[model samples]
Target: MISSCFVTAIQVLILFTLSSPCVRASTFTGSMFEVQISTKLPVKDWVKEAKKDSDPFSLWDPTCFKFVSAIKSVDNQLKEALYTCHSVPGGDENTRLKIYLFIPPERLAPEKQEPCLRAAYKKAFDDWKAGVSANFQIRPEQVQFSCELSV
Candidate 1:
Protein backbone atom coordinates (compact mmCIF):
# COMPACT_ATOMS: atom_id res chain seq x y z
CA MET A 1 0.00 0.00 0.00
CA ILE A 2 2.79 2.39 0.88
CA SER A 3 4.53 1.66 -2.36
CA SER A 4 1.36 2.27 -4.30
CA CYS A 5 0.82 5.55 -2.53
CA PHE A 6 4.38 6.59 -3.24
CA VAL A 7 3.98 5.77 -6.89
CA THR A 8 0.74 7.68 -7.03
CA ALA A 9 2.44 10.69 -5.49
CA ILE A 10 5.21 10.49 -8.04
CA GLN A 11 2.73 10.27 -10.85
CA VAL A 12 0.84 13.27 -9.59
CA LEU A 13 4.04 15.27 -9.31
CA ILE A 14 5.06 14.39 -12.83
CA LEU A 15 1.65 15.26 -14.20
CA PHE A 16 1.64 18.55 -12.35
CA THR A 17 5.07 19.43 -13.64
CA LEU A 18 4.22 18.59 -17.21
CA SER A 19 0.80 20.25 -17.08
CA SER A 20 1.90 23.42 -15.31
CA PRO A 21 2.81 25.16 -18.55
CA CYS A 22 -0.53 24.37 -20.11
CA VAL A 23 -2.33 25.68 -17.04
CA ARG A 24 -0.17 28.78 -16.86
CA ALA A 25 0.37 29.80 -20.45
CA SER A 26 -0.93 33.25 -21.37
CA THR A 27 -1.44 32.86 -25.10
CA PHE A 28 -4.06 30.06 -25.12
CA THR A 29 -6.32 27.78 -23.06
CA GLY A 30 -9.02 25.10 -23.55
CA SER A 31 -10.07 21.57 -22.60
CA MET A 32 -8.55 18.50 -24.23
CA PHE A 33 -11.49 16.68 -25.85
CA GLU A 34 -10.80 12.95 -25.98
CA VAL A 35 -12.45 10.52 -28.38
CA GLN A 36 -12.07 6.74 -28.52
CA ILE A 37 -11.58 4.91 -31.78
CA SER A 38 -13.49 1.68 -32.23
CA THR A 39 -10.84 -0.17 -34.20
CA LYS A 40 -7.27 -1.07 -33.43
CA LEU A 41 -4.51 -0.15 -35.83
CA PRO A 42 -0.84 -1.07 -35.80
CA VAL A 43 1.09 1.33 -33.59
CA LYS A 44 3.35 2.78 -36.24
CA ASP A 45 0.59 3.02 -38.80
CA TRP A 46 -1.69 4.70 -36.30
CA VAL A 47 0.77 7.45 -35.35
CA LYS A 48 1.75 8.00 -38.96
CA GLU A 49 -1.84 8.41 -40.06
CA ALA A 50 -3.48 10.37 -37.19
CA LYS A 51 -2.38 13.94 -38.00
CA LYS A 52 -2.80 13.41 -41.73
CA ASP A 53 -6.58 13.11 -41.66
CA SER A 54 -9.35 15.68 -41.11
CA ASP A 55 -12.48 13.87 -39.91
CA PRO A 56 -14.36 16.16 -37.58
CA PHE A 57 -15.27 15.11 -34.00
CA SER A 58 -18.89 16.09 -33.58
CA LEU A 59 -20.09 14.05 -30.60
CA TRP A 60 -17.29 14.66 -28.13
CA ASP A 61 -16.48 18.21 -29.11
CA PRO A 62 -17.91 21.00 -27.01
CA THR A 63 -18.41 23.66 -29.69
CA CYS A 64 -18.45 26.54 -27.25
CA PHE A 65 -14.64 26.44 -26.93
CA LYS A 66 -11.51 26.33 -29.10
CA PHE A 67 -8.24 24.63 -28.13
CA VAL A 68 -4.48 25.01 -28.75
CA SER A 69 -3.16 21.43 -28.60
CA ALA A 70 -4.32 17.97 -29.84
CA ILE A 71 -3.00 14.52 -28.93
CA LYS A 72 -3.91 10.81 -29.36
CA SER A 73 -3.96 8.20 -26.62
CA VAL A 74 -1.83 5.10 -26.98
CA ASP A 75 -3.47 1.67 -26.97
CA ASN A 76 -2.75 -1.06 -24.44
CA GLN A 77 -5.02 -3.91 -23.47
CA LEU A 78 -4.09 -3.60 -19.82
CA LYS A 79 -5.18 0.03 -19.66
CA GLU A 80 -8.19 2.06 -20.76
CA ALA A 81 -8.36 5.75 -21.74
CA LEU A 82 -10.68 8.59 -20.74
CA TYR A 83 -10.60 10.69 -23.90
CA THR A 84 -8.85 10.24 -27.20
CA CYS A 85 -7.02 12.96 -29.13
CA HIS A 86 -5.41 15.71 -27.12
CA SER A 87 -5.43 19.01 -28.99
CA VAL A 88 -4.29 22.60 -28.52
CA PRO A 89 -6.43 25.37 -29.97
CA GLY A 90 -5.29 28.74 -31.37
CA GLY A 91 -1.84 27.43 -32.18
CA ASP A 92 -0.30 26.12 -35.36
CA GLU A 93 -1.75 23.78 -37.92
CA ASN A 94 -2.40 20.24 -36.70
CA THR A 95 -4.87 17.86 -38.30
CA ARG A 96 -7.60 17.53 -35.66
CA LEU A 97 -10.91 15.79 -34.93
CA LYS A 98 -12.68 18.80 -36.63
CA ILE A 99 -14.21 20.20 -33.44
CA TYR A 100 -12.65 23.47 -32.27
CA LEU A 101 -12.70 25.50 -29.02
CA PHE A 102 -13.80 29.15 -29.18
CA ILE A 103 -12.92 30.50 -25.72
CA PRO A 104 -12.44 34.24 -25.33
CA PRO A 105 -9.06 35.69 -24.39
CA GLU A 106 -10.52 38.12 -21.86
CA ARG A 107 -12.06 35.30 -19.81
CA LEU A 108 -8.85 33.33 -19.46
CA ALA A 109 -7.88 32.04 -16.03
CA PRO A 110 -4.39 30.59 -16.08
CA GLU A 111 -4.45 29.57 -12.43
CA LYS A 112 -7.84 27.93 -12.55
CA GLN A 113 -6.84 25.66 -15.40
CA GLU A 114 -6.46 22.61 -13.16
CA PRO A 115 -10.16 21.90 -12.62
CA CYS A 116 -10.92 21.54 -16.30
CA LEU A 117 -7.73 19.67 -17.01
CA ARG A 118 -8.28 17.34 -14.10
CA ALA A 119 -11.82 16.77 -15.18
CA ALA A 120 -10.69 15.97 -18.68
CA TYR A 121 -8.10 13.53 -17.39
CA LYS A 122 -10.61 11.78 -15.19
CA LYS A 123 -13.08 11.52 -18.04
CA ALA A 124 -10.44 10.03 -20.28
CA PHE A 125 -9.79 7.15 -17.91
CA ASP A 126 -13.51 6.66 -17.46
CA ASP A 127 -13.99 6.50 -21.20
CA TRP A 128 -11.32 3.87 -21.45
CA LYS A 129 -13.03 1.59 -18.98
CA ALA A 130 -16.43 2.25 -20.41
CA GLY A 131 -15.19 1.14 -23.81
CA VAL A 132 -14.49 -2.36 -22.58
CA SER A 133 -17.76 -2.63 -20.69
CA ALA A 134 -19.60 -1.46 -23.79
CA ASN A 135 -17.71 -3.96 -26.02
CA PHE A 136 -15.86 -1.11 -27.70
CA GLN A 137 -12.39 -1.92 -28.91
CA ILE A 138 -9.55 0.61 -29.13
CA ARG A 139 -8.34 2.18 -32.36
CA PRO A 140 -5.34 4.10 -33.54
CA GLU A 141 -5.54 7.87 -33.33
CA GLN A 142 -8.78 7.18 -31.50
CA VAL A 143 -7.26 6.60 -28.10
CA GLN A 144 -7.49 9.05 -25.18
CA PHE A 145 -5.50 12.29 -25.29
CA SER A 146 -5.31 15.80 -23.81
CA CYS A 147 -4.34 19.34 -24.98
CA GLU A 148 -2.46 21.84 -22.85
CA LEU A 149 -1.30 25.41 -23.57
CA SER A 150 1.74 25.69 -25.82
CA VAL A 151 4.79 27.23 -24.26
Candidate 2:
Protein backbone atom coordinates (compact mmCIF):
# COMPACT_ATOMS: atom_id res chain seq x y z
CA MET A 1 0.00 0.00 0.00
CA ILE A 2 1.18 3.53 -0.82
CA SER A 3 1.97 5.66 2.22
CA SER A 4 -0.17 8.73 2.87
CA CYS A 5 2.89 11.01 2.74
CA PHE A 6 3.94 9.50 -0.60
CA VAL A 7 0.46 10.01 -2.03
CA THR A 8 0.38 13.61 -0.81
CA ALA A 9 3.80 14.27 -2.39
CA ILE A 10 2.68 12.76 -5.69
CA GLN A 11 -0.45 14.92 -5.71
CA VAL A 12 1.57 18.04 -5.05
CA LEU A 13 3.96 17.18 -7.87
CA ILE A 14 1.11 16.61 -10.28
CA LEU A 15 -0.55 19.88 -9.32
CA PHE A 16 2.69 21.81 -9.68
CA THR A 17 3.34 20.25 -13.08
CA LEU A 18 -0.18 20.96 -14.25
CA SER A 19 -0.02 24.59 -13.10
CA SER A 20 3.38 25.44 -14.57
CA PRO A 21 1.98 26.29 -18.04
CA CYS A 22 -0.56 28.71 -16.56
CA VAL A 23 2.17 30.53 -14.65
CA ARG A 24 4.32 30.75 -17.75
CA ALA A 25 1.41 31.90 -19.89
CA SER A 26 0.61 34.72 -17.47
CA THR A 27 4.09 36.13 -17.86
CA PHE A 28 3.50 36.85 -21.55
CA THR A 29 1.68 40.17 -22.04
CA GLY A 30 0.27 42.22 -24.95
CA SER A 31 -1.92 45.19 -25.89
CA MET A 32 -5.70 45.02 -26.01
CA PHE A 33 -8.89 47.07 -25.74
CA GLU A 34 -11.88 45.53 -23.98
CA VAL A 35 -15.52 46.49 -24.42
CA GLN A 36 -17.96 45.08 -21.89
CA ILE A 37 -21.68 44.83 -22.48
CA SER A 38 -23.99 44.31 -19.53
CA THR A 39 -27.35 42.82 -20.33
CA LYS A 40 -30.35 41.20 -18.64
CA LEU A 41 -30.65 38.42 -21.26
CA PRO A 42 -28.50 35.46 -22.14
CA VAL A 43 -25.36 36.63 -23.94
CA LYS A 44 -25.72 34.27 -26.88
CA ASP A 45 -29.27 35.37 -27.44
CA TRP A 46 -28.31 39.02 -27.12
CA VAL A 47 -25.47 38.67 -29.61
CA LYS A 48 -27.66 36.81 -32.04
CA GLU A 49 -30.24 39.55 -31.86
CA ALA A 50 -27.61 42.21 -32.31
CA LYS A 51 -26.06 40.48 -35.30
CA LYS A 52 -29.41 40.28 -37.05
CA ASP A 53 -29.14 43.92 -37.94
CA SER A 54 -27.31 44.89 -41.09
CA ASP A 55 -23.68 45.88 -40.69
CA PRO A 56 -23.44 49.06 -38.71
CA PHE A 57 -20.97 50.66 -41.09
CA SER A 58 -23.25 49.98 -44.00
CA LEU A 59 -26.09 51.67 -42.18
CA TRP A 60 -24.45 54.36 -40.04
CA ASP A 61 -23.07 56.81 -42.64
CA PRO A 62 -23.09 55.26 -46.06
CA THR A 63 -23.52 58.58 -47.76
CA CYS A 64 -20.20 59.86 -46.51
CA PHE A 65 -17.46 58.27 -48.59
CA LYS A 66 -14.81 59.85 -46.36
CA PHE A 67 -16.24 58.27 -43.25
CA VAL A 68 -16.45 54.85 -44.90
CA SER A 69 -12.89 55.18 -46.14
CA ALA A 70 -11.71 56.18 -42.69
CA ILE A 71 -13.39 53.20 -41.07
CA LYS A 72 -11.90 50.82 -43.59
CA SER A 73 -8.49 52.34 -42.95
CA VAL A 74 -8.92 51.81 -39.24
CA ASP A 75 -10.06 48.26 -39.75
CA ASN A 76 -7.02 47.47 -41.83
CA GLN A 77 -4.80 48.62 -39.00
CA LEU A 78 -6.20 46.40 -36.23
CA LYS A 79 -6.57 42.69 -35.62
CA GLU A 80 -9.87 40.87 -35.46
CA ALA A 81 -11.91 41.49 -32.33
CA LEU A 82 -12.51 38.56 -29.98
CA TYR A 83 -15.74 38.15 -28.03
CA THR A 84 -16.50 36.28 -24.80
CA CYS A 85 -19.60 36.10 -22.62
CA HIS A 86 -20.35 34.98 -19.09
CA SER A 87 -22.90 35.33 -16.32
CA VAL A 88 -22.47 37.97 -13.66
CA PRO A 89 -21.88 36.68 -10.14
CA GLY A 90 -24.29 36.87 -7.18
CA GLY A 91 -27.29 35.80 -9.28
CA ASP A 92 -27.87 39.29 -10.61
CA GLU A 93 -29.77 37.87 -13.60
CA ASN A 94 -27.38 39.68 -15.87
CA THR A 95 -24.74 38.66 -18.40
CA ARG A 96 -21.43 40.28 -19.18
CA LEU A 97 -20.22 40.12 -22.74
CA LYS A 98 -16.61 41.09 -23.36
CA ILE A 99 -15.15 42.12 -26.70
CA TYR A 100 -11.39 42.07 -26.97
CA LEU A 101 -9.53 43.90 -29.73
CA PHE A 102 -6.01 42.61 -29.68
CA ILE A 103 -3.32 44.90 -31.06
CA PRO A 104 0.00 43.33 -31.82
CA PRO A 105 3.06 45.12 -30.47
CA GLU A 106 4.36 45.84 -33.95
CA ARG A 107 0.97 46.99 -35.24
CA LEU A 108 0.12 49.25 -32.33
CA ALA A 109 -1.15 52.56 -33.63
CA PRO A 110 0.24 55.88 -32.56
CA GLU A 111 -1.65 58.11 -30.12
CA LYS A 112 -2.86 60.41 -32.88
CA GLN A 113 -4.52 57.51 -34.73
CA GLU A 114 -6.37 56.15 -31.70
CA PRO A 115 -9.28 58.58 -31.67
CA CYS A 116 -10.36 57.61 -35.16
CA LEU A 117 -10.40 53.93 -34.32
CA ARG A 118 -12.14 54.57 -31.01
CA ALA A 119 -14.82 56.64 -32.67
CA ALA A 120 -15.46 53.97 -35.27
CA TYR A 121 -15.68 51.27 -32.61
CA LYS A 122 -17.96 53.40 -30.46
CA LYS A 123 -20.32 54.10 -33.32
CA ALA A 124 -20.46 50.43 -34.29
CA PHE A 125 -21.19 49.46 -30.70
CA ASP A 126 -23.84 52.13 -30.40
CA ASP A 127 -25.52 50.97 -33.56
CA TRP A 128 -25.48 47.41 -32.28
CA LYS A 129 -26.98 48.50 -28.97
CA ALA A 130 -29.75 50.38 -30.69
CA GLY A 131 -30.55 47.43 -32.89
CA VAL A 132 -30.57 44.84 -30.10
CA SER A 133 -31.99 46.82 -27.19
CA ALA A 134 -35.58 45.66 -27.60
CA ASN A 135 -34.78 41.98 -28.02
CA PHE A 136 -31.90 41.73 -25.53
CA GLN A 137 -33.39 43.92 -22.80
CA ILE A 138 -30.26 46.03 -22.53
CA ARG A 139 -29.77 49.77 -22.66
CA PRO A 140 -27.10 51.70 -24.51
CA GLU A 141 -25.72 53.12 -21.27
CA GLN A 142 -24.55 49.75 -19.92
CA VAL A 143 -21.59 49.28 -22.22
CA GLN A 144 -18.11 50.10 -20.90
CA PHE A 145 -14.75 50.43 -22.58
CA SER A 146 -11.39 49.66 -20.97
CA CYS A 147 -7.92 49.70 -22.48
CA GLU A 148 -4.84 47.77 -21.43
CA LEU A 149 -1.43 48.32 -23.02
CA SER A 150 1.82 46.60 -22.22
CA VAL A 151 4.72 48.85 -23.10
State the C-alpha lDDT per candidate: 0.30, 0.35
**Candidate with maximal lDDT:** 2
TM-score of each candidate structure, all chains considered together: 0.24, 0.36
Question: Which candidate's TM-score is highest?
Answer: 2
Q: List the residue pairs that clash in candidate 2.
A: none
Q: Deviation in angstroms for 11 in model 2?
A: 29
Question: Lowest lDDT 10-mer window, candidate 1?
Answer: 1-10
Worst 10 residues of 2 by lDDT: 1-10
User: Candidate 1 local accuracy as lDDT?
Assistant: 0.30
* Candidate 1 per-residue lDDT over residues 1-151, each given as its tens digit: 0111111101111122232455432222322233323343233444444445453332223221112121223243213222222322433323233222333222233443456654563454454445432432333334433333322
Query: In model 1, how large is the Cα lDDT of residue 92?
Result: 30
Off by over 4 Å in 1: 1-98, 101-110, 113-121, 128-136, 139-142
lDDT of 2 by residue, 1-151 (tens): 0010011101111111222455322212233333344644443443454455465432322222212232233333332332211222335544443223333333334343465655664565455445344333457566444443333
